[model samples]
Structures are given as structure tokens and as C-alpha cells.
Target chain A: MTSGLDVRGITHRYGKKTALNDIGFSLDKGLFCALLGPNGAGKSTLFSILTRLFVPDAGEVMVDGHSLAREPGKALARIGVVFQQPTLDLDLTVRRNLKYFAALHGLAGKDADRRIETSLEQVNMAERAAEKVRALNGGHRRRMEIARALLHGPAVLLLDEPTVGLDAETRSSITGHVHNLASEQGLTVLWATHLVDEVRGSDHLVVLHRGKIHANGNAAEIAGDVSLQTRFLEMTGGGK
Target chain B: MKAALICLVAIVHREALRFVSQRGRFLAAIVRPLVWLIVFAAGFRAALGLSIQPPYQTYITYEIYIVPGLCGMIQLFSGMQSSLSLVYDREMGSMRLLLTSPIPRWWLLFCKLFASTAISIFQVYTFLAIAALTGIGFSPAGYLAILPALIVNGLMLGALGLLLSSTIRQLENFAGVMNFVIFPMFFLSTALYPLWKMAEASTILRDICAFNPFSHGVELIRFALYGQVDWMALLWVLLAFAIFLSGSLWGYDPSRSMVRRKA
Candidate 1:
């Protein structure tokens, strides 16, 4: 069986400085994987490579059995991404934003409307669908972005620092929502962040430090006797 | 194929909606041309003399002579405005969303060019209508004939804008583009003065104006507005469009340093 996402021997560099060094990982369907890394750990560069914004120097990415290099369109069709920065048009309403995204993915008319509605409901933003994005709070805007990402019903969702700048309560709520998406809806998720508390004990955790993976396994097992925070600090050189 | 069409429509529709929401932009697009037609043309009518050009069968007023040039000006500014927005979008991260779509990257960039061209064409027609209301009118058939010319010219200028946007790394640097590119291209072209007038002053300046692609765009519009065709101008504009579009495509390729540096 094909993994939901497979990164094999991926390497990337900017000039003489390597950004990602032989990084490799995989996730099965319906799994929530946390890619925990501190600042300058090359998380953004890896996301850029995965999203095809930058081509890797070596290796390949497989998304739901589709090779990113050989069949980019098919691979892209299966992957939805929410970048660390907000991508919504602040002047446009919530529904209009989702409709625009849906149309980009070839959804139109009744089908587009249905998906927009469903996605908004998933994020509990259906009631505010008519509101302009500029009128929403930071947490709500993040929710709207998540809704837009899911409008095309992508098989794998990749979020880079999704909960950054949100309140602790909002962050936990958003994280809980995404975990529910993986568990109940059978969606695959790779959530990248520096927050250790966001990783559940049972979740798959991949610790990336200085462009290399230091640990990848069940979160509890990786933590072992120590707390996840202490283990993460040790793996990443005591937070440098 | 259907998906591509849908994506194209969506992009164009979004551009139109954004254009409508920014009333200041629409007003600026119209007022700039109108100012040239009403004020500068009036001031220069006595100083400059226009002979019987191919597009002009007889002596014409300065306003009538400069109308096509002003149309080109509208498109030129509109194209640059579109480029400025592209730079802003890139900085704001919306461009990443567009580039990561399932559709081909070239197709996405083309869609953006098409949307910019469509918006410019609409602005040109609106400017033309305002000029007609001011008693500077073209042949009835010329109005209909100018549509195709406007589209081609708009696309050529829009492609140039796309090329510039792909190379421009930040929004703050766009002012440099205006001073270095927009002013020189507009002033050095056949927009305000005829090539013959430039020749009387200096042969070198005249040759430079004649060689400018924007001059060909204006001449193409001028002839098309009089129910005629300038085949040379048409060919030159098309060639420039091809070159600019190709450069923009290369600039936007993922492997290229232009985009990689940004990443």
C-alpha cells in the first residue's frame, strides 16, 4: 500500500549552505504527524520544496502514490497547504475567498458551493461566511484559511506554523480541530511547529534540527522517561 | 481543459471584482488620459504641427492626434499597476497559493496576464468613450475596429509587466521601475510627439522613438482607430509580446534563481 506522503532522501541547498540534508519520512493515511523544529531548522525550506515553490537538489516526494517530479499535477491535486503567512484576500468575504480557491481547483457552480459550505462548517465559520475577512479576528482568519485549504477535499494537508501568533486557547482549539480531522475524517496531516505541547502522546513526531531529522517515532516512545519538552530540547542541542 | 477554463474565468472574475472595489484605481486610470487629452494637448496644439499622416487623412487637432497615444498611456500605467499588485501579492503570500494550484505554473501566470489585459482593455474603452463625449470622436467603424488593437497592445504591455514583476523582489522597489522604465518608455515613444517632429530635432532621438516597442503599440492603435492596419506595427508588437512572455515564463520557473532567491 502507498503511504499518504513519502519523502525520500530529499536534499536542498542555498549556495554553499545546505537547507535540508537527506531528509526522509513517511506517514500512513489517517495519521497526524507533528514536524517539530525550532527557528532556522529548515522547516520553511522543506515546505517550499514539498509545495514545488523550489525544486530540491535531490530526491523525490510522493503524495498518495503520485510522484511530485513526474506527475506534479496529480501530486498537487492530492495535497493542500496552509502557509505560515496568511493567504486570504482580506478585502473579500469569507465565502468569496473559498469560492475563489474552489474554482482554482476546478470546482464550480453547485459543487463549489457545497464544498465551500462543508469546509466552512468544518471550521465552525459557516455563520460568518458573509463577513469580510478584514472584519475577522486573527484566530478566525486562521480558521478561514484552514477552511479554504480543505475546500478541494485534498487527501493530505500540510500546515507550516499554522497556529503562530494565536492565543493559547485558540491554538489548542485549532490543534484539536486538526487532530479530529485526522482521526474522524481519515485525512492525513503534517503540522509543522515549534510548540511541544501541541504534540499529543500518541501522535507521530518528527524532530528536525539544523536540516536533519534527529528523531521520528511515536511521541511517547521518543519522549521515554523524560517529558517531551526535555527530550525535544536535548535532541535539538538544548535549544541551541 | 474544462478545469483550465474554469480557473481562467475565476482569475479574471477576481481581477474584475478587485478593480471594482478599488474605485480610486478606476478613477486614476480614466483621469490620467483625460488630463493629457484636455490640458496637455490644448497647451501643445499651437507649438506642434501634424502633417497628413497615414492614419490621419488630413490636418487634425492635437487632441485627436494624441488620443491613441493617451490610450497607450492608460494601458502602460495599467500594466505597471498590475505588476505592482503582483509584487504585493508575492510579499503577502497570496502568490504562493496561486502558484501551488494543480494547474501548470505557466498557465497560472498566463491567466494573470490575461486578467490584467482584460482590465486594461476595459479602461481603454472607458477612456475612449469619455473622449468621444468631449467632442473628440473617431469614425463609427473605428470604435469597433479598435477593440482587437487594444487587446493586442494590452497583452504586450501586460506581458512586460509580468516579466518585471517576476524579477522585482519587493514592493518598495517598484518606484524604481516607474522612474527607470515607465517614464523613459512613455517619453521616448511616439506618445506626445510625432516621429517626424523628433527627426526635425535629431535623427538619433527619432530613431530611438521609432525603435521603441511602445511606439509600435500606439501606431497600431492609431491606425486601427481609423479603420486601417499598420502591418509593420502589428508584427513588431507581436514579436515584443512573444519575447516578454517568454522571459516572464523563464523568470517564474521554479529552478530559476529569481524565484529561488525569494524562497
Candidate 2:
């Protein structure tokens, strides 16, 4: 069976500097994979490749059985993305933002409305749908973004450093919410972040550092006798 | 095909919605042209005596002569404004939402061009209406004929904006666009003065204005406003549109360094 997300021999470079070096990984369905890496660890580059925003110099990405390079439209249709930066229009209402995204994916009219309602309900932002994004707090705006990403009902979700800049409590809540999405909805998720605390012992773990994958396995197994935090630090050389 | 059409409508609707919310943009678009038609034209009327031009069968006042040019100016600025917004979207990350869509990238870009062109057309009509009320009017049929010309010219200018946005990485650098692009394009074109008038000044300057695609665009609008077709101008504007659009697509290609360099 095809995996939810599969990358092989993926490589990218910026001038003479290598950003991602022969990175390869795979995740099964209903799994919350934490792509733990420090700043400039190539997590964002990898995410960009997966999202088809930047084509790799040499690599292949398979999203739900479709090859991204050869069949980008079909592969892209199967995935949703939440970028490291906020992407919503602050002047538009939450519902309007979601609706605009829905239309980009070819969903419209009543179908778009239903999906918008369902996604908002999932994120618990249904009550704030009428409020402009500028009126919402940082956490709520992030939730609205997640709702916006989920509007098209993709099989795989990719979030790049999504919890950055939020308070600890809000970060934990968002993390917990995303974990529930994977476990409850059979959605495969790749959550890229530098925070070691966000990775659960049972979760899939992939450590990226300086353009390479240093570790890829269950979080507990990768940590072995030590804590995941120590293991992450050791692997990334304190993420310097 | 159906999905593509739906995407097109959504993009256009969103642009229109944004246009409505930004009331200042609409006001500025209308006011800028009026300032020229009412104030600048009044000052230049006596200085620049007008002979019957192709589009003008009889002697006309300076205000009437520059009306088509003012229409072109509206689209030119509207196109650049749209470009500024695109740059803002890129820096602000909203463009990621657009580029990641399942729809073809070319189609998405085209939808944006179409939407901006639509807005430009709307602004042009608003200006023309106010001008008509002020006693500077064209053939009733000429008003209708100008629609197609406006679309072509708007697309050409909007495509130029798209090309610029794809290459410009930061919002701060966008100020240079107004200086290098907007001012030169507006002033060098036949928008403010006819090419013959420029010829009277200097052959080289007239030649430069003649070669400027924006000049052809103004000529197209001018002829169409009088129920005439300038075949050469139409072809020149279309050629410029195609070149600019293709360049933008190349610039936006995922394999290229434009998007990657920004990231």
C-alpha cells in the first residue's frame, strides 16, 4: 500500500550552499509525525518542496500514491498546507478567508459552505466565523488558518512551524488539537517544528539537521534511554 | 473546464470585494484622472493648439483631447496598484495560499490578470461617466466600442505589473516601481501629449514614445473611443501583453530562482 507521504532522494540547494541533502522519509496514515529541527535545519525547505512551491533539484515526493513531479495537480489535490507564516487576509472575516481558499480548490456554492462550516467546527472557531481576522487573537487566527487549510478535505496535511510565536498554553492546545486530527480522522500529518516538547513518545519522529535527516523512527525508540529533548540536542549539536 | 471557470469567478469576486472595502483605492483611482482632466487640461488648453486628429474629426478642446489618455492612465495606475498588492501578498505569505492551489498556475495568474483588468475597466467607466457629465463626451456608440480596447490595454499593463511583482522580492523596493515604471510609462506615452506633439519637440523623443507599448495602448483607446480601430496599435498592445505574460509565468516557475530566492 502507498504511504500517506513519501520522499526519496530529495535534494535542494541555494547557490553553493546545500539546503536539503538526499533527505528521505515516509509516514503511514493516521500518524502525527514531528519533523524536529532547529532554525535553518532545512525543515522549511523540505516543506516548500512537499507543497510544490519550490521544485527540488533532484528528488521525488509521493502524496497519497501520486507522484508530485509527474502528476502535480493530482498530488497537490491530495494535500493541505499551513505555512510557517500567517497567510490569511486580516481584513476578511474568518468565513470569507476559508471560502476564498475553498474556491481555489474548485469547491464552491453550497458545497463550499458546508465544508467551511465543518472545518470551522473542527477547529472550534465556528462561533467566530463572522469576525474579521484582525479582531481575532493570535491563537484564534492560527486556528482559523488551520480551518482554512482543512477546507478541501485532503488526505495529508503539512504544517510548517505552525505554532511559532504563540504562548505556551496556546501552543500546547494547538498541538493537542492537531494530534487529535491525526488520531481521530485518519489524516496523516507532518508537523515541522523545533520544539522537542511537542513530540509525544508514541509519535513518529524525524530529526532534520543541517540539510540531513539524522534520525527517523518512533520518538521513544529514537530517544532510547534518554529523553527526546536530550536526544534531539545531541543529534542537532544543540541546533547551532 | 467547469472547475477552472469556478476558480475564475471566485478570484474576480474576491478582488471586487477587496476593492469595495478599500474605499480609498476607488476614490484615488477616480480622483487622479479628474485632477488632470479638470485642472491640468485647463492650464495646457491654450498652449497646445489642436488640429483634427484621426480620432478627432473637428477641433476639440484640450480636455477632450486628453480624455482617452486619462482613461489609459487610470488602467496604468490600476495595474501598478494591483502589482503592489501582489508584492504585498507575496511578502505577507498570502501568495502561498494562491500558488498551492490544485488549479493550474497559469490559470490562476490569468484569473488575477482578468480580475485586475476588470477593476481597471470599472474605474475607467466611472471616470468616463463623470467626464460626460462635465460636457466632455464621445459618440454614444464610441463609449461602447471602448470596452474591448480597455480590456486589451488593461491586460497589457496588468501583465507588466505581474512581471514586476514576480521579480520584486520586497515591499520597500516597490517604491522604485513608481519612479522607474509608472512615471516613465505614463509620461513617455501618448497619454499626456500626442506623438506629433512630441515630434514637434524632438524626433528622438517622438521615436521613443512611438516605441513605448503604453503609447500604442493609449492610441488604441483613443481610436476605439471614436468608433475606429487602430490595427497597428491593437497588434502592438497584444504583442506586449503576450511577452509580459510569458515573462511573468517564467519568473513564477517553481524551478526558477524567483520564488526560491524570496523564500
lDDT of each: 0.92, 0.92
Worst 10 residues of 2 chain B by lDDT: B254-263
**Model 1 residue A58 distance off true place after TM-score fit, in angstroms:** 0.9
lDDT of 2 by residue, A1-240 (tens): 889999999999999999999999999999999999999899988988899888999989999999999998999999999898999888888888888898899998999999999999988888998999999998998888888888888999999999989999999999999999999998999999999999999999999999999999999999999999998989987756
lDDT of 2 by residue, B74-108 (tens): 99999999999999988888888899998999999
TM-score of each: 0.98, 0.98
RMSD of model 2 against the true structure: 1.0
True contacts kept of each: 0.77, 0.75
Which TM-score value belongs to model 1?
Answer: 0.98
Clashes, model 2: 0
Candidate 2, residue B52: Cα displacement in angstroms equals 1.7
